[model samples]
Target chain A: MSPADPIQVHLVRECAQRTKYVIDLPEPLSLQAYQELADNLPGILSSVFLPSGDVLLQIKLLEKEGSITGSTNSATLHVLLTKEGHGRLLEHILQELRNQ
Target chain B: MIDIREKVQFVPHLDCGSLILGGEPHVIHCHYYNHFLQTSIEDADGIYPAEQVLVGTAQEIGHSQFRKLFQEKGIQDERERKSFVEVVYSLLGMGKVSLENVSAEGGEISTPYEHYAYTYAATFPPRPKGKRGVAYFSQGYLAGAIEAICDLPLGSMGSRQTACLTQGDPAVSWEFFRLREPLPLQPSVGEGRYQTASLPQPPHTRVPFQAIRDAVLGLPLGPDPETGLIEAFDVVLTRLPGNYYALISERHFQHMLSAIGPDVIPLVLDMLVESGHVCAFNTLGGIMCSAEWDAVVRPYLDNPADWLYGIVALMPALGWGIVEPLTYPSSHSWTVSLHNWYETTAIAALPNGHTLTYSPFAEGIMNGILALVYQAGIAEKRLTFDGELYGSLFRTGRTYQSTFHQSRLQGAPTDVVEGHVAR
Candidate 1:
């Protein structure tokens, strides 16, 4: 809930090994946090730094909607686009934010 | 403690080639189609009264449907009726809701599983305002169900989604209350005027319509016992009311034509039709490449072009209508006719039958069927579907197109959709 608290991630829809997920940031992701996620993304995921200061992700990771909640109203970044892996990519997103 | 799922039945009107549930036709469509069509209507928010059109259509259909269901079952108890509404809502894979304290006067109800909100949030990634309470369909649907349960006159009740789980809330919630002034609603034409003739059986086609239809219907297309969501054919499925789709699309077309003028015709028509393309590309393509297709319908695909026959045969089972191929197997340069197709039927049922031309949904499907059967490489199971795939296949490259020779709503013998070769 705090600005420095770790983000919450939830799975949305997964089909044909492709997925969609949300990583709730109570506060908007700092540029550094976005950068850290991009840098730390699994090799399967190729990240493109968007001009709008958001990251657009393509599922190089090949993978997965569930009841999604806990995203804040600040802004929805193309942040940590997790759609191709199991829950690990989402866990990676949350853990990396915690490390940050 | 009756088993709820077992209670719901999709009776086959094989002669008409339709599935009737709770006295209304139902069709199986995926999230892509639902999301696309819903957003298309939502996109015209300011241009027209989009919310009114969307919510009102749902409320109207839901009211008509529940009223019949309650009578058929003789469900007299208020609590039993409420429980019945919730069960059917989930049974159809719309999403599960807690109608725990919901009633006719007004009430607040929430669920993590409402279809529209959850799917919308999943489809579009995080946005600044956070998309909340997008369950407009549920808003109107539950409202109508309550009114029927209470035996209230149509439009006596109204509902609004207050919070959406997709919006970061723990659940999607709605506030239902008596409308200060009841809406003058159009009674839902439960089943439209459909021409009944023997289904077209082209002599050369190897796939027999009756055989495939019976097999496809036998497949378990029901919702998960727990989540009440159907994840089949590689897409989340919903047994959506046939009238809900008919009312929204036809109403939107009418609104655009009247308010925006004829100059907007080409643009609006193209956009509306694209939802069908999205359905065929994703839903149809997904089915062709699915294991279920291999098990049930695949054996009938005796020839390369028979894929078209095999797929169309399953249309009725999905409650779309009786799809008869006027032209034989080859994908391109063929014509398909629809009898009692939900879109046209729903529209004709409208008082003073509206003139919306050929159904955009059918046109898109006609074009998409060809593309999926031939272009997407589904025969080889080499489909690589994504957001980009639609563009590459439909918007660009050598793309297919459909020309509507006749429209059922326009007093044609039947709805005819002809597919032309790629441009």
Candidate 2:
């Protein structure tokens, strides 16, 4: 894919009870790229990769009861990504985005 | 009189608690008689008996060693012998010693001892604080060394540490007096034998003040492994009084934190945060604050972003290990993880075992700095620990999370704060 081309990975909820998210990739990733992405992701967000080769991105999102109520609370985003999905994310950030 | 500038060679080796110096191995250790007496001695009356026995025994041992070393050198001249004794004292890391007046006939010497080791060691205990010139082991060592060199009879001399650094004196001064009668011994308790306990050792490596200062000064001002901004903080911390940076040994730092206790940690944090505010205002003032935010901290000011990068860059200056950032399921709030934190490590190093204590002072300091830089009030702060790494976060604030939370509530406002925008 080109640097300007958008590579969007779909976020799939892993479990209904938890805030876990998993991103499935269209292609399998090389071991080298997966490792590189794993090493570098800490610079962006606090995350860990599961033994199943899925990356978990943890984020805190602000949640409000309703649009009209306006009272807000905090929530965590447990995002998981497949090896290929992580590789694409890293490529888009480190390579393509930097070129722009 | 021997010249004061003569250099002496010393070989040192650490053997258990003692720091043995010189070729023949003259052993010297910073003994904690006070700690032993306080913890082990049962009755108030038993204290003096225990102290006398312990000090006398140590003195006798020191005297024999000094006699052996002196005789081996075969220095007949009195002044030369005294000078040699001074060198030995200095070589043992016992601080500098200079004799002022020596009276051979009177059997006394007036000397000034600067940076005596015992005085430095005494400052660690939070209670039963030290009095001026109460370094028993040091006083005993000095007397023994003098008596050995002078060839005086055993127990013929008594020395008093007149001035002490613990009492804010620049140096400890000693006045040695000739004793007409033999030393008096008090009755001993528990089968006429005294038991001594050792002081707790520091967990982290103790770097000399000069070494730390030099290392900090030698750091490159340009972008290096860590950011120069953090290096600047290192310089400031090193320059604080009483070797504040080096004095903060891992064990001692932990002791101080545990002493504060968990219930008091939040209050201490709040106080530190307030202090940070006052300090920030005094140093940077209100005007230059915006210009001082580094690249790492600038971007996070507007959006709800992870602050791990900034914390990681700043950890070394704070004397911490690599921090792992952790996130909770509820609230997009993130907390920095403290791995092998000074307190945690120190508590683990305790010999008698220790109860778990948590202090959010580190988190408070970070939050305070962030609040000051972003020019925002802290809204919600929470601290948690999971056996290891202590995790903490500020959920609501105008700076990182607060600004992001506010924007999210107001339909994702595009405009950033004026301070962050200026950057």
Candidate 3:
């Protein structure tokens, strides 16, 4: 996938009343792969926020036969915060992903 | 095959909240620890003098983690942000725990096995979404779950000298109220009767006294002081079962009075004996007026304005019962009745003063009493002077029986003293 291309990503709330942030991957992603990435997402994202503002991002990965693979990965970014004070939280995620 | 791995349901109600520690999401289980945290942390500093240090430490840690998580996650997206925060809020529903300053770091901290413990049985808020749903979690949720569980830290140390070590933060209020000291002895007078030293009357104080007096006149006085006498107000503050702190009104004193019958008196006692405070007072006898002591303790005990827990054992009788598996249960050592009985009974008049009697119903009351007292002295290895005196006085044959009593066996009495008649 080219970085310039518009990656298809949807920011959806599974429950109207709940505040959980869910990003649907176009292809299947295995439970373990999703969890491993999700577990580190907070810390990685916390470390990557830019001085300018909040980080906006998401990743798409393949889930084949209910198993996750890095090659199947895709990405999206969201400006979750306006001020850099807390905005880097999202940036940290992108930075960690880039580092990986 | 029943696939347990499938995405079942995420019940928002089941979520207690989450604690973000080190950027890790720690999910709080509502059923497990929500109410516990609410009571622990609602306070500004999470300070409490409970025998449980874990609870205090957990509260402080949880609070800090919570504040940080929110500060870091300034969720701007309306939909996604709500979901994230709802999870956080549910986790906060878990109880709080904190600790006193490290008491000699690196040393082993005490646990429940070695100290007094307390817990609030609370009711929780229902699921925010529709009622029907189960909570599902992936391994990613474990870190948060563990963080939440870590909130209630258990400590075994109790500050009392007889206790091994103080376990909990001593600042938190407890359901049990103690008097400052033991009842001061009224000066002894001629004859067996107590001189009943006159107490200083309530001064012609202004304001509050007038308010109380006016309130009293509005109500009908009962037959006797014991019945109608509104001695003093006992204020009880307790964290209720429904995740709230309830302040019992003054009217609730009637319920307390009924629970711990009128026989219990508020005598002038030492602060340690009275133990009205949550912490243990030093055991020392200090001269103070009895009425003054009673007045000091009356407000906390008598006023219903005090906070009371829904599950608190207010009455001594309600406190009695062998909690199952008696060994590890918290109620095992609950001596409410025994303590109350000891307080009401005069130790000096008993066959063995100071030495507590374990058995009450013996066939030969006197013989059993003497034998038990005698045995106690020998067991303590104090059979020299006072011990010897007790042994001799309580021996089977040496005890004096009143003439014309049931079996006043006299003359060449082969055996059978009053204490050993049935034994």
lDDT of each: 0.72, 0.33, 0.21
lDDT of 1 at B18: 79
The superposed Cα distance between candidate 2 and the true structure at residue B304, in angstroms, equals: 36
Tens digits of per-residue lDDT for model 3, B1-423:
322112112221111111113232222112212222222222212223221222322322333333334455442333333234333322222112112221211111112211012122111233233221111110112112222223212122112211111223222221111124422112111011101111111222111322222222222111111111111111001111110111011111123234445442121111111121111000000000011111121233322211111001111111111001101111111111111111112222222222212212111222222232333322222122222443354333443211111211121111111222211
- iRMS per model, in Å, is 18.2, 21.1, 31.5
Q: Pick the candidate with the highest TM-score.
A: 1
1 against 3, candidate with superior lDDT: 1
Q: Candidate 3's error at B56, in angstroms?
A: 20
Candidate 2 C-alpha error for residue B16, in Å: 11
Could you give the candidate ranking by lDDT, starting with the highest?
1, 2, 3
Which candidate number would show the highest lDDT if scored against the true structure? 1
Docking class of 2: incorrect
DockQ of 1: 0.03
